[model samples]
Target: MTIKKKSRVTSLAAGRPPTARKPKSISRKATKALINTHHVLEKKKAQAIAKGDRAAEIAIESEIDALGGIEKYQLASLQGQRLDRGGDSSHILMEWLNSMDSTISSSAGAHLKMLEVGALSTKNACSASGFFDVERIDLNSQSDGILQQDFMKRPLPKDDSERFDIISLSLVLNFVPDAMGRGAMLLRTLDFLKQPDTQYSSGLRTFFPSLFMVLPAPCVTNSRYMNESHLETIMNALGYVKAQSKITHKLVYHLWVRKSGVQCPPATFKKTELRPGHSRNNFAVVLSGSSG
Candidate 1:
């Protein structure tokens, strides 16, 4: 969804205290319903366009409107992310960062800059850690700190000063409706990451520039066209090497370091099925042209 900037109007002074304004608890079932319905409608719309079925495309649009549009989908997603709901993925990221050497804290001359895409709240673990200087953005801003902007529309960095040490795509890649767009999004991260250099020489802490990504477990585990090995192949092709990963029953988290001079895989990736099953999903990441 393309989000336009809107004035943030609030009655905080007269309303209840800020802590009392928490997102109301949403049932897991209801949240899943909203998110699933939105994905289905978006997929149908994409298929209609592919087949040149204008009538079907219009029908899908109406269905989406009836579902309360992208705003409703975003709200459901945000609710699902509330800390009480096992929504914040940054806790895993923080764990990985703490395990790394030469840790950079606020005391360091510079904090590691992070571009957090699809950020839902300004209070996630990463924001509170005091280790990262985060730039939060989302397609639809739910709070004051997150900028209402699409990651694809973000301007390209001019040089090192404009780049970041890490880019977090927590549950954001799966939000793109199409596979090709997902691949493009991954590649785009490389452009925003700092180029390899001697550790601490530039006042930055040790460690390579990295991409921290989180996705629904099914996107890899139960997809017809993608699996763990396939995903690793794709990332390796893009000059990334997995540094850490943790897979749960519902979610998968990965941290891929941007390697300095590795060559991309010899072949391109497409939606060819790697696993055949009627229940498998269509999740895929298809790269066009060269990777990295």
Candidate 2:
């Protein structure tokens, strides 16, 4: 006789399903902690927006403070002191002022020609009206008629035989994708500004002897390739020397002089230092043609 073993019955077999594990409940303290963390993150984001919104105001206030408040201005006026006097940039301003004093000429009659690369609103605004016969050349195809025309297609006028006293390439180098490309573009700019005689002349010569390059300051571009040293190196390689340098709010203005007769000293590195009896922070560099 064959005997069949009885099957063991589970809770499911008995019409009661096995008890499922329940999720652990969060404590009130943990819930509050999570809420607090979320709030902190939101607060930080708000603070960042506030900071960004007030950045310009902060910068202006800082500048005024550096200038020694209202008393400094009073003293400056009393002493007949020009605020920007002895700043290496006086030469450029003097040249511009001298030009302005002369008879006003048509945009065509102006002796000095200017080629502004990467034409932006700031460059356009700072540009002297009737100051050096100005011609704007932008690379963006969309900027047609806004400037004279795009530089890539309509090359600078070959017939007009005037050389620019100053050629400005402002705040545009960092946008170049690579160093080789940037170098090529820089060379091209130099080539365009260069006088035709230099192209055929025997001696080592340049097209436009004066170049004002306003590069992105330490604060402007995030790219490693774009910096003060890099720009100086490029200019030096192209046979230009730093004639003047000033650290303004948004940019590093460098007035470069092509192998001119005047040999200026190299730029000196000066750490801003606070001293006793000094009205404000002072930079220690001795201004000369060459960098110290």
Could you say which candidate leads in lDDT? 1
**Cα lDDT of model 1 by residue, 1-292, tens digit:** 9999975657775376764465466688999998998998998898899899999999999999999788778779878777778858999988877765344643456667899999888998889888888999998787789999899999999988889989999988988889998988987888789876626543233345888999999998999999999999888878788988999998999988876643534446788899999999999999875644
TM-scores, in order shown?
A: 0.86, 0.42
Q: For candidate 2, write residues 1-292 as lDDT tens digits.
A: 9999986766553653432322234444553344334333333434444578566545555555565443333233222212233222223433443443433333234355666665533223335444555666654322343364544455544643644556776645543433343455555554455432333222222223567765435422333223456556546655577766777653566667665232234332222222333233111212222321
In angstroms, give how far residue 154 of model 2 lies from its true place: 5.0
Q: What would the C-alpha RMSD of candidate 2 be, to one decimal place?
A: 24.0
Model 2 CA lDDT for position 16: 38
